[model samples]
Target: MDVPHPFDEAVATVKALAPAVRSESVPVDDCLGRILATEAVARIDVPPFDRAMMDGFALRVDGELEEGITFSVTGTLAAGDAPTGSPPAGSAVRIMTGAPMPADTNAVARFEWCEESTSSQHGTTAASASVRLLRSVRAGESVQPRGQDGGAGTVVLGHGVRLAGAHLSLLRTYGIAHLSVAKRPTCSIIVTGSELCRDTEALLAPGQIYGANDAYLSGALTTDGIAVTECSYVEDSRDAIRTALVKAVASSDFVILTGGVSAGDYDYVPRVIADLGGQIAVRRVLMRPGSPLVAATVEGAVVFALSGNPAAGFVQFETLVRPVLRQAMGWHDEPFPASGRLLHTVKQKPVRHTRILRGAARIEGGVVVVDTEMAQAAGQISSFASANCLVRLDEPHVEAGTVLPLRFLDGALSSR
Candidate 1:
């Protein structure tokens, strides 16, 4: 077996091998959660015309606001109605929210502050009524000026932003019907183990365990907006593994294989990858739970072989595979670790390798506190029940109240 590379060096190698980002034009309706490949600049000013911000009366104000000022209501305007000739002096237009303001209107008085009079005896009918302002008004009140939200040529959303629901609304307001976004990476999963069963409904035979890594990895990648092309289950036989690898590499940009990377009689993943013309860049890493990780490139597809251990595979995917995938999608920023104080002492024999422990993190008095009481075995997945973070430790044992580096599992801070 070859000497394992340092954890940081191994991660760097895998990330550096990521495929280049590609872009495609997609309708804005389907762009949620996709990274923008180009800046979304407004083609036209939002609120193309001066608009009403509330249900009110549009009036032409020349000077100081006067109390009890009466104006003849010339016409009623609703949203989407084209502006007619501006009302004569001392006349106003009844407008609804979102209606375009008349060219001559300078101010709006909300209905709450104005009283309407339709007395025919005063030479005024309902069609042409009088409105009296009960309170003083200010110029531009209840009006949305043209380009108030955004002006033409303004960069509403910069490149590399992950589109969300709110972003879609903003884009539509600027008449952006489509957007250039990073293409989602295609991936495949190859699970190899003779003792693994893929069916969840069938009863497990003696000495056989249900395969879980496949479902976990597939769901995680899908949630991250990746296209999982295929998921294959193969035995430890070299022939089966090779055939699966060939198909996966041919069809997907990324292939993730669980099990069969370590030095064992049944471990044929690395050997088969090499036989299939793969250039191995990373053989192993100096990290606990996921030290036997391997990265290679075969026919332009990056392959990752992670430990079969459930906990180990989960840790490797979150720490290593996820970053490379994000980079391939044009997201260059990394998730920064948060400083967390240990709430309980963690007792474990120290090894030369860096240990990553499952933890439950919470905010206490504005400080991040983590609990590492869950099972930390490589094969056990019970830790996932409450573990939201992975605590990084260099020392053998840590005492309570010691501050350590913690990485949130979802890449965002969601403390209990």
Candidate 2:
């Protein structure tokens, strides 16, 4: 029997399955790509006080002066050290970069612009400094005022923000050592087929072929950060399928099974899941090659049964499973296919959703061009190896200028 489209059912299932994972506090060093659970507020104002931007003398500028005027140097200040009290009127304080400007000192004159000399002032030994009236130093010139970058009680980062390298640096600037982040979800894969053999050298008999679904499923899941801890191969027997399902459901948050989902008598996945009190949410999809896709929840654990064919299983995972995984991991956006124009004409079934074969994407004449390859058979695995995207075919046939939805094989195009 024909089944509802898996894409439609996948959206409903994800909405129904509320986020079950909790949040945890982790060190900022390990929070890259993790979702923030709370807003990060600045504990103190950035550059808490007025400070000098360069090595100069802190003095109150009266009027433009010639070489005759002189001022006594009170004391010296360096970065990270306190200034020797405010400089008295008619005198200057020697200060370095990052040193706090003394109170009542309105401006700073760079060392290169002033001339140094020695003279006795008020019967005390002191060095006289004067500067030719090259330019006037205005108040607060070249000084970073207090709270210029950030102020206390200000929200620096908001909740649900994905931490990047720059965000981490800001967190360090605020002295944030630990941050609250959402926990990541876990997933498992199960491969089933009697004709499937691990070692290719172990020649297959008349009705046998090497299993490629396990490798494809495992690699895809791993790239998404989903842990595939359980990988088992079961024959077409009912008892073996039941055992694999029970074990996988117990240990994994989500169970992915390859093969044994079709309607044939030997296809035991549906029966085993039903016998274990699992409800089949979706039994089939409208898409070609992946028409036998199945989704069920076995004892509260999500289970996805895909076709034995590698291409079919891979496409099913990218379209239906990846988005659910991302949601379970607390990602805010739904992972969907990118939209691009077709480079060549392609045909499809009128009533069913089709995925046309495509190679890689290139930019030609400042436009994206998706190259099409030969028609790939449903069961062919080699065609998907180098394939990057599945040009969605909503209608039976499409022309070269058609604007179609393109789902990337990997998560690469989801960003576009």
Candidate 3:
């Protein structure tokens, strides 16, 4: 069967493969950054009861208080205390923030507006003292009612939502101890090339170069929440390549081998994968710098073979591998549509595929602006180092002032 375009086909393949990672019930604290597989319904109201909005007197006002009035202090209510009965007539309850409001109380008089007897207005203080109201409050004023955030059975977290710190706080408020999150997938990567060396500390031979693809891929995988169990390096020999590929596949849900996807004399990844009972799903892509990108499926897992060149593999990872990996983790959010205006000029000859140029994205006024002058070459590591985003250009030459969508990598455009 014919494969669809790389960008689309890769995603479709992932989605059509095994079902969304199995849902594992885990302690809420352990599920940070994991994809939520089920809707988190509140077993009870978020606050569970009407709570005080501030540390002040909670008064039951049937109608707007036309004038300030002093009231007897009925009792003090702390955060964990249950609601007391209705306040004594002409009396008020001193409540703290997160404390349950007294029954029949409609509003709280903040301390700033309340003049009380005694040096301090303590909630646990005796009722002998009184609070003088500086201003009149209407019914329900300053009172947080039950179910203000959501009532019982309301969905606080929808399915497929990525969990974060704030989300955890909300769930914890409802006493949710465990969550059903998508199971994390295991991944392994292979770095292939005779010219590559693992130890940066050692002196290099004339033809030797420090391999960076492994580090780059590992960082990206970790950031996306995929745990890499094995990261191995192999020479360009077919035997070495085949051995690493077979072992990586045996233990990981996904395998990534950098190098050998191209047609160069030493590029043997494609043939090795085919010989090892794998089918090449995509040999080329509609993208610049990473056009030689290759994807395949074996036994039921996915394999990505990227260009041996550093910059080329980097682009492929950003443009293609990330989205596929996210999808495999059960997240459906697309990653390539974010946009920013060009802050500088970038010129390039037209090509059959899209191009990704590295740069920094900054917010000017209200819109996002991308600067791309330093990202003209693929092999320059400094370009990727200083860049916070990548500008995707489909046109032959993008002018200086054109507005284009950008793929932000360094959280530079998050605030924008």
Off by over 4 Å in 2: 51-79, 90-133, 199-208, 335-337, 354-359, 383-385, 408-416
Q: For residues 1-416, could you state the per-residue lDDT of candidate 3 as single tens digits?
A: 23335455554554454335677898999888999988998888866788888788888888877456988887888889887489888998888888888777888888888888755535885343788888777887777788888888988889899998999988988778899988888899999999998999999999999999989899988988999989999998999998888888889888888988888888899888889788776778777677787788876668889887899888888777777777777887454668888876676776666777887888878878888878556677778877888778878777777988778887755444
Query: Could you tell me the lDDT of residue 290 within candidate 2?
Result: 82
lDDT of each: 0.89, 0.74, 0.81
Give the CA lDDT, 0 to 100, for residue 129 in model 1: 84
C-alpha lDDT (0 to 100) for residue 263 of candidate 2: 89
The residue ranges of model 3 lying beyond 4 angstroms of the native Cα positions read 1-19, 68-70, 111-134, 333-335, 414-416
Ranking according to TM-score, highest score first:
1, 3, 2
- Give a tens-digit lDDT track for model 2, residues 68-147: 45667777778888765777877877778888888877567777766666545656645445433244566676578888
Model 1: weakest 10-residue lDDT segment is 119-128
Residue pairs in clash, model 3 = 339-405
By TM-score, how accurate is candidate 3? Answer: 0.89
Question: Which of the predicted structures, 2 or 3, would earn the higher TM-score when compared with the native?
Answer: 3
C-alpha lDDT (0 to 100) for residue 63 of candidate 1: 67
